[model samples]
Target: MILLIPAYEPDDRLIALVTSIRTAAPDVHILIVDDGSGGAYGAVFDGARGLGATVIGHQANRGKGAALKSGFRHAGRTHPGEAIVCADCDGQHDVDDILRVADRVRTARTSMVLGARQFSGRVPVRSRFGNAVTRLLVRLATRLSLQDTQTGLRGYPASMVAWLQTVDGDRFEYELNLLLHATGAGYAVEEVEIATIYLEGNASSHFRPVADSVRIYAPLLRFLLSSLGAFVVDTAALLVLVALTGALLPAVVGARVLSSTVNFLVNRTLVFARGTDKPVRTAAAQYWLLAGVLLAANYGLLLVLTQLGLGLLPAKVLTEAALWVTGYQVQRRFVFAPPRASAVERPVAEPSRALGADVR
Candidate 1:
């Protein structure tokens, strides 16, 4: 098993973590990527190296995603078929938990194992709130209920190294992107509960709440903005068409056609299918089919709401809110999903002693 840690401006805790791992799991190869921690952290990296861990260097901070990829590439070249487990360098991850995740990777060899934190006990306010929001967004986006979307303790089989390297995002967003696309890429995610440790109220965390939050939630935010833009176009066109034609059906149809077209274009090029090789024509066909169904549902809901003593604008608002989640799910799972690779078949193994009940 290979244990990969990505460190940037680390402290003595890093050294202590390395020493503990060396003592607990001596055979596990430790690989650390110094993500441009510079000379100030040289002693820390040296200590890790002196403890028999190989250290990789990056000239400047390229973000956690880049550091992990560097470690993955190096592990592929050096360890070849060994299962890899990634843990944070700040000592939040227990050595026993690390070994547990490592064991799962070795046993499963086809699933992505996550060292999920319980988030119980005294957790930081930002950390708790951030995880909750991200967890909800991930569930909404992928229909996969993950307990911890932001955990750095993850395990991947050797077969997944190439695919992991292909995942996008250079920073914190990279981990979320991986979870979003993992099922589509034919990998199952299994979670193992680990202790949640917040040292000094997580002050050592380099995460910038505002900047990194935008990047992490960029996909969902883009879709939301696209929907809002289309809503404006749809509502305006609907009102104008109603005044011009005095027919609700024609007005709704015309408005939806214009708005859906705009929404489709933006979502395809910028939001869901960006940088993908999936054919535009194929996606368009799927998208239009979905739009047609949504349009019918939209019209039906609008008519029902208006008949229930609601004003036209109020009905429109209510109708859109009702269908918003449905639209995102269908578009993400079917319309814009990438082509899946062949999945490996493996038997479900019983949970290890460190493993907990599965999160819904």
Candidate 2:
């Protein structure tokens, strides 16, 4: 098995991360994908090489997605049969977990194995919220119940390695794009809970929360924009329900039930279009499950907020905002993914020009 590290000017931290992998899994070949780190970081590669890692250098910074594509391509040609696991250059990932996850990938030799961080602690506030939103988008897009959709620590079987090279998203958001595309190609995603070390308060990340959040959720945002009418229906339902039942949980549930169904119907018919490689029966089940989990979480939050010295109306608003993030995370990760059909013979709906995202 080959361990793939996509690095751009890897500092001492990456050198240590690579070193730890060397210590933990000596049998696994390490591939450092250097994206133009300049002369200053050349020593890091030399050190990694000394510690038993093959360095593939990119002349310029081509972004994380591009680096991974290049690295996977290199692994395909060079290692050929060994499985590849992609790990961040940042030291946040646990080497032991990588070993464990990679072992499963090596043994099963099929599914994509993801390192899922325990979000209860260590995760930054912005990171938590953004991931929650993206996770839902992935659920809706791919109909895969993923615990941590944005986690960069992932293992891939060698058979499907080449397809990842053509997919889009060169930045951190590429993780989202990879997952969506993987599901579309009918690959199964497996989660492995990993220990996360957020050094220096997690401030070193390259992802621009708001801008990248838009990009990460690009595919699903388009779907939601197309479903704007459903948003209005949901808000209207909420207002009418509160007026009728004094903002009780049942009323909130009733409102969300009606509104979410409207959104679901629009997504199923419009965004998903029943023609992708995804199995309709399983996808539909995952869709309802995603909505049910979000609805429960939304209403539960409202109940807690209302009981904690706040007005029901404001509580509803706060909880709804929370749900919006949560719902997007679950739906996008599991629901709206591309299908496994080798080729889409007939697109059920023309790609909506109005809902397209500016990836650049």
Candidate 3:
């Protein structure tokens, strides 16, 4: 097993963590990627190197995602088929918890094991609030109940290294995208409860609350915006077509054709993007199948409401409002599901006593 830590402008805590990890898990290969922490932090990286960790450094700072990708590439070339345990260097993760995550990685080599943090007891207000919002968004977007969407302690299988290298984002958004697209990559996700420690309200952390939050939420926000734009187009076309033709069926058909085309184009290009190994035919077929079902149900509902004395405009509003959530859910699950790859599962290794030792 290998432990990969990405460090930037780190302090003595990094040095201590490296020294302790070396003492506790001598056989575990440690790679510390110095993410452009300048000459002032050179001694700390050197100290980590002296303590038996292999330190890799660059002259300028890239974001955490870039740093992690560097580590993944290095591990892919060097270790080839070894599980990697990733932990934060800001002392939020203890050595024992790191090993615990590492052990889980061994057993779940075909899966991504997340060290889910329990946000309790004197946690920073921003961290707690940020996590709460992100958790809700993830649930709404993917229907996956993830306790910690912002956890830094995670384990990756060797099989996933190539995919990770290909993932987008150079900073915080990269991690969120990884979780969002994990299912598409055909990797099962397992979460293990772990300790949450915020040092001085997580002062050493480099996350920008406002800017980073926007980036993290960009994908979901774009989806919503796209849907809203389509809704406006659909509603306007329906009203205009009704005014012009003075007929209910013609208005509905004409309006729907325009709206559906707009929706499909926006979703295909922006929302449920198609840039993967998964063939477009599958998603296209599924999407049209869903559209057909929704169209029938929508027209049926409109007729029923109109026959029961509702006006055409009111019926259109009610029918569409009913199908809104259903459309979103179907598109997300069927049209945007992650592509899965064939994996060769490796055997689980027993935990070493050295790795299991408690070291704070």
| The candidate that achieves the highest TM-score relative to the unseen native structure | 1
Q: What's the ranking of the predictions by lDDT, best on top?
A: 1, 3, 2
Tens digits of lDDT, candidate 3, 1-360: 999998899999998888888888889999888877888887887788778888775557778888787778777777889999999898999888898989889988679999999997999988998899999877776567889989999999888887787666878898888877776566778898899889887999999888888889987888778877877787799889889988877777777778888888788878766433347787767777888898888889988999999987788778876887678767765675555322233222322232221110
lDDT of 2 at 250: 69
> RMSD of model 2, in Å?
9.5
Off by over 4 Å in 2: 229-360
Indicate whether candidate 1 or candidate 2 has the larger TM-score.
1
Model 1 worst lDDT run, 10 consecutive residues? 351-360
The digit string of per-residue lDDT tens for model 2 on 1-360 reads 988888876678888887787777778888887776777777777888778778777666767887787777677767777789888887878888888889888865558899998787666778788778777767655667888988888998886676566566777767887787675465788999988667787766776767777767766666667446665676678778778887576676787678777777677666555324467777668877887887788778877887798986687667665556455555544575544322134222221232121100
lDDT of 1 by residue, 232-322 (tens): 9999999999999999999999999999999998898888854255798898898999999999999999888888899999899989988
TM-score of 3: 0.83
Worst 10 residues of 3 by lDDT: 351-360
TM-score of 1: 0.87
TM-scores for candidates 1 onward, in order: 0.87, 0.65, 0.83
Please identify model 3 stretches exceeding 4 Å from their true place: 240-253, 272-286, 297-360
Q: How much lDDT does each candidate structure score? A: 0.85, 0.72, 0.80
